[model samples]
Target: MDTSQHSMHNLFEQLGLPSSEHDVEQFIRTHRLFSQDIRLDKATFWTESQAEFLREAFEEDSDWCEVVDELDSRLRS
Candidate 1:
Protein backbone atom coordinates (compact mmCIF):
# COMPACT_ATOMS: atom_id res chain seq x y z
CA MET A 1 0.00 0.00 0.00
CA ASP A 2 1.07 3.57 -0.54
CA THR A 3 2.33 5.49 2.46
CA SER A 4 -0.80 7.63 2.63
CA GLN A 5 -3.06 4.59 2.86
CA HIS A 6 -0.70 2.85 5.26
CA SER A 7 -0.57 5.90 7.45
CA MET A 8 -4.36 6.19 7.46
CA HIS A 9 -4.70 2.48 8.20
CA ASN A 10 -2.27 2.48 11.09
CA LEU A 11 -3.84 5.51 12.69
CA PHE A 12 -7.30 3.93 12.79
CA GLU A 13 -6.02 0.55 14.00
CA GLN A 14 -4.16 2.34 16.80
CA LEU A 15 -7.42 3.91 17.82
CA GLY A 16 -9.26 0.56 17.63
CA LEU A 17 -11.43 1.93 14.89
CA PRO A 18 -12.31 1.02 11.31
CA SER A 19 -9.50 2.06 8.96
CA SER A 20 -10.38 1.06 5.40
CA GLU A 21 -10.42 4.02 3.06
CA HIS A 22 -14.08 3.60 2.14
CA ASP A 23 -15.25 3.13 5.73
CA VAL A 24 -13.14 6.02 6.92
CA GLU A 25 -14.53 8.27 4.25
CA GLN A 26 -18.08 7.27 5.12
CA PHE A 27 -17.53 7.92 8.81
CA ILE A 28 -16.07 11.31 8.02
CA ARG A 29 -19.05 12.24 5.85
CA THR A 30 -21.46 11.44 8.64
CA HIS A 31 -19.44 13.01 11.44
CA ARG A 32 -21.39 16.20 11.45
CA LEU A 33 -24.01 14.26 13.37
CA PHE A 34 -21.60 14.12 16.30
CA SER A 35 -19.40 17.21 16.18
CA GLN A 36 -19.06 20.75 15.00
CA ASP A 37 -16.01 20.05 12.87
CA ILE A 38 -16.71 19.60 9.18
CA ARG A 39 -13.27 18.48 8.08
CA LEU A 40 -12.74 14.70 7.97
CA ASP A 41 -10.89 12.03 6.01
CA LYS A 42 -9.30 8.62 6.34
CA ALA A 43 -6.47 10.13 8.40
CA THR A 44 -8.66 11.62 11.12
CA PHE A 45 -11.83 9.58 11.59
CA TRP A 46 -11.58 7.17 14.51
CA THR A 47 -14.98 6.74 16.13
CA GLU A 48 -17.11 3.80 15.10
CA SER A 49 -20.62 4.65 13.98
CA GLN A 50 -21.80 1.12 14.79
CA ALA A 51 -20.73 1.61 18.39
CA GLU A 52 -22.49 4.91 18.43
CA PHE A 53 -25.62 3.27 17.06
CA LEU A 54 -25.52 0.57 19.71
CA ARG A 55 -25.14 3.13 22.48
CA GLU A 56 -28.12 5.08 21.25
CA ALA A 57 -30.07 1.85 20.75
CA PHE A 58 -29.69 1.21 24.49
CA GLU A 59 -31.85 4.26 25.10
CA GLU A 60 -34.49 2.27 23.19
CA ASP A 61 -34.36 1.37 19.51
CA SER A 62 -35.31 4.54 17.80
CA ASP A 63 -35.63 5.17 14.09
CA TRP A 64 -32.62 7.41 14.34
CA CYS A 65 -30.33 4.63 15.51
CA GLU A 66 -31.65 2.28 12.88
CA VAL A 67 -31.01 4.89 10.25
CA VAL A 68 -27.53 5.47 11.59
CA ASP A 69 -26.68 1.77 11.51
CA GLU A 70 -28.12 1.37 8.06
CA LEU A 71 -26.13 4.30 6.81
CA ASP A 72 -22.88 3.02 8.25
CA SER A 73 -23.48 -0.52 7.05
CA ARG A 74 -24.18 0.76 3.58
CA LEU A 75 -20.93 2.63 3.57
CA ARG A 76 -18.96 -0.38 4.84
CA SER A 77 -20.30 -2.48 2.01
Candidate 2:
Protein backbone atom coordinates (compact mmCIF):
# COMPACT_ATOMS: atom_id res chain seq x y z
CA MET A 1 0.00 0.00 0.00
CA ASP A 2 1.15 3.55 -0.60
CA THR A 3 2.12 4.97 2.80
CA SER A 4 1.30 8.50 1.69
CA GLN A 5 -2.27 7.48 1.01
CA HIS A 6 -2.39 5.84 4.42
CA SER A 7 -1.23 9.05 6.01
CA MET A 8 -3.91 10.99 4.16
CA HIS A 9 -6.53 8.80 5.77
CA ASN A 10 -5.53 10.12 9.18
CA LEU A 11 -6.94 13.58 8.51
CA PHE A 12 -7.65 14.29 12.15
CA GLU A 13 -4.02 13.75 13.11
CA GLN A 14 -2.88 15.95 10.22
CA LEU A 15 -5.04 18.68 11.75
CA GLY A 16 -3.52 18.07 15.23
CA LEU A 17 -6.47 16.10 16.51
CA PRO A 18 -6.69 12.47 17.72
CA SER A 19 -5.22 10.03 15.20
CA SER A 20 -7.65 7.18 15.62
CA GLU A 21 -10.36 6.69 13.01
CA HIS A 22 -13.02 6.39 15.70
CA ASP A 23 -12.00 9.63 17.32
CA VAL A 24 -11.85 11.36 13.96
CA GLU A 25 -15.35 10.16 13.12
CA GLN A 26 -16.63 11.22 16.52
CA PHE A 27 -15.12 14.65 16.13
CA ILE A 28 -16.73 15.08 12.74
CA ARG A 29 -20.07 13.90 14.04
CA THR A 30 -20.03 16.42 16.85
CA HIS A 31 -18.86 19.45 14.94
CA ARG A 32 -21.16 21.58 12.84
CA LEU A 33 -20.17 23.45 9.69
CA PHE A 34 -20.70 27.19 10.17
CA SER A 35 -22.79 27.24 7.01
CA GLN A 36 -23.34 25.07 3.98
CA ASP A 37 -21.67 27.65 1.80
CA ILE A 38 -18.73 28.32 4.08
CA ARG A 39 -15.35 26.71 3.53
CA LEU A 40 -13.68 24.47 6.06
CA ASP A 41 -11.31 27.21 7.18
CA LYS A 42 -14.33 29.27 8.11
CA ALA A 43 -15.96 26.50 10.09
CA THR A 44 -16.67 27.49 13.72
CA PHE A 45 -15.25 24.34 15.26
CA TRP A 46 -11.59 25.12 14.66
CA THR A 47 -9.33 27.44 16.63
CA GLU A 48 -7.77 30.37 14.83
CA SER A 49 -4.45 28.57 14.50
CA GLN A 50 -6.13 25.49 13.16
CA ALA A 51 -7.99 27.56 10.60
CA GLU A 52 -4.79 29.31 9.59
CA PHE A 53 -2.99 26.00 9.18
CA LEU A 54 -5.74 24.73 6.89
CA ARG A 55 -5.83 27.89 4.84
CA GLU A 56 -2.06 27.88 4.41
CA ALA A 57 -1.94 24.22 3.47
CA PHE A 58 -4.59 24.81 0.85
CA GLU A 59 -3.05 27.98 -0.53
CA GLU A 60 0.41 26.44 -0.72
CA ASP A 61 -0.96 23.20 -2.17
CA SER A 62 1.26 21.38 0.32
CA ASP A 63 1.27 17.64 0.93
CA TRP A 64 -1.25 18.23 3.70
CA CYS A 65 -3.71 19.69 1.22
CA GLU A 66 -5.16 16.33 0.26
CA VAL A 67 -5.83 15.40 3.85
CA VAL A 68 -7.16 18.84 4.63
CA ASP A 69 -9.49 18.64 1.65
CA GLU A 70 -10.59 15.21 2.75
CA LEU A 71 -11.42 16.51 6.20
CA ASP A 72 -13.30 19.40 4.67
CA SER A 73 -15.34 17.04 2.52
CA ARG A 74 -16.12 14.75 5.42
CA LEU A 75 -17.04 17.60 7.70
CA ARG A 76 -19.35 19.13 5.15
CA SER A 77 -20.92 15.81 4.32
Q: How do the residues 1-77 of candidate 1 rate in per-residue lDDT, one tens digit apiece? A: 33232244554454466889886676557653443342222213435663553456436755344444454344444
Highest-TM-score candidate: 2
Q: How accurate is candidate 1 locally (lDDT)?
A: 0.47
lDDT of 2 at 30: 88
Candidate 1 Cα deviation (angstroms), residue 25: 0.3
Error of 2 at 44 (Å): 1.1
Q: Candidates' lDDT values, in order?
A: 0.47, 0.76
lDDT of 2 by residue, 1-77 (tens): 33465354465665678867678778878885746789888877788988998899899987778878877777777
Off by over 4 Å in 1: 1-6, 33-77
Q: Each model's number of backbone clashes? A: 0, 0
